[model samples]
Target: MRVDEYNSFANQLQRYASALSRLESLHIRLADGCRLRAYQKRLAQVTVDPRSAIDSQLVIAVTYDLREIDEVNEIVENLPATLDSETLTLLQKVASGSEHPDDELDAPGREAQYELYLGTMLRRGGIPARHGKPDLVATWHNKEFFIEAKRPASAKGFDNRLRSAVHQARALVRPGIIAVCVDQLVRPADGLMVVKDFNALAPSVDNLVRKFVVEQAHTLRKRLSTNEPVAALLLTARVPARIAATGHSSLGTSIQLHPLLAGSIEAKFASSIIPLFAGSPS
Candidate 1:
């Protein structure tokens, strides 16, 4: 009511504002890496002008509004839309407790599956192929060899994955072939639950495939090509399947080929040798 009383009230208000600003600064710092919260905290804290002497009063006023029940309600109402769809879905999963957890990433196990499948595919055809780290090791036509697998064509970073696979394959042997496999998902059953979220998971499928097939092939090829017994090949999904070898020079390499869906894997294994020996060598 009096001049001194009004001054005292103003000072008290300013102190409260200062305290609120400090709290907001702390909140902003803590939220730095939190993508969604970071933006919200920033919008709340940004000063219209930082250099002005009266900016402190403005900051205090803003903080007062931001801390109110009404302002908190407003922020909560609009926070979800800015997040990515996948991240939002994950947030929902976290909220509802519906997401599944993986026991392990299982990189090597999948690699072994590719190795066994390639070996079975070639060996059944009497190519004398066996699974080897970095590539398949085979003794076809009295020559030692290596084979690498490449992933399908319609994917990104196939080249980079291929490079790493080649580097890894090189460690195992010299003169290897880098093979790629391109196709739709090839689980034994289309209806089976092979993937948790196929649409979300499809983009990453080829990366793993390349790791399983191409990386191994590149490693084996590098090792075999040095005349120290190495070879590599890529089994890309094609209308007609083919074989390629890159370990040897003039003697060259060969592929005992098979049709993409000639029959069950067992049947194709039996029939592939005819093509290996019968097809003209490159």
Candidate 2:
């Protein structure tokens, strides 16, 4: 879907009060001072005057929180009985940790959200996935696969996060995928990304993702070479952007898959499972 189209749909579908009530129904309550509440207030201010100066960071937070709320709601609705505890625990963590003063990218809330997001995506893709020790686990083609989702706060911490995920996967003794969200790495901190036209949105985001992949290529290759259980690295990023011509705001997302060495058992497993996520969300 086009970026603006997604923004319009999401904005229409997600309302803060409704989302909060849905979470409350699930026994998850957010503190009044939580970052999400702050985002909602910022969103309200923006809605009051669309042409006013926009806070780029607030825009990113609002967009991200909306999608997260929607995804989590769907997860709870379709969740299997066995995963009830796991899902609730993660949700509770997100609710509680969100109020922390230092709850940035490295906060437990962010990590739990990432796990929930991946589990939601996997389930939506027709794979039976559950949240757990390695973050997430799923069954595809009669084989169980583990997934460790990580979102480093900064580029310098990427290696450590990757190693931690690899270790978790190795401990499980199952074929696995290391899923990393590189939004912080790709997103510009100064301001929202501006593209000349709608057509430029995707390529602008893709170029940033490609650059990140290239910079991390050696590290990823070295990890895959030694970690037999890890079949592939899945990198995903979402950047808040605006179209200069139309003055429309949206998010540009990119997802890329990097497989293990050419002729390995792990690589073969990755190939077999790739089809399951063919049309996964951006």
lDDT (0 to 1) per candidate: 0.34, 0.66
Candidate 1 segments exceeding 4 Å error: 1-110, 150-154, 184-233, 238-282
Clashing pairs in 2: none
Residue 115 of model 2: what lDDT?
A: 83
TM-score of 2: 0.81
Judging by TM-score against the true structure, name the best candidate: 2
Question: TM-score, each model?
Answer: 0.30, 0.81
Model 1 CA lDDT for position 89: 31
Off by over 4 Å in 2: 1-5, 9-16, 48-83, 96-105, 261-282
Worst 10 residues of 2 by lDDT: 1-10
Instruction: For candidate 1, give the lDDT.
Output: 0.34
CA lDDT, candidate 2, residue 216: 86
**True lDDT of residue 64, candidate 2:** 50
Cα lDDT of model 2 by residue, 21-113, tens digit: 666777777777876566556556666655666776665555555444444445454455555788889878765444322235465676787
The clash number for model 2 is 0
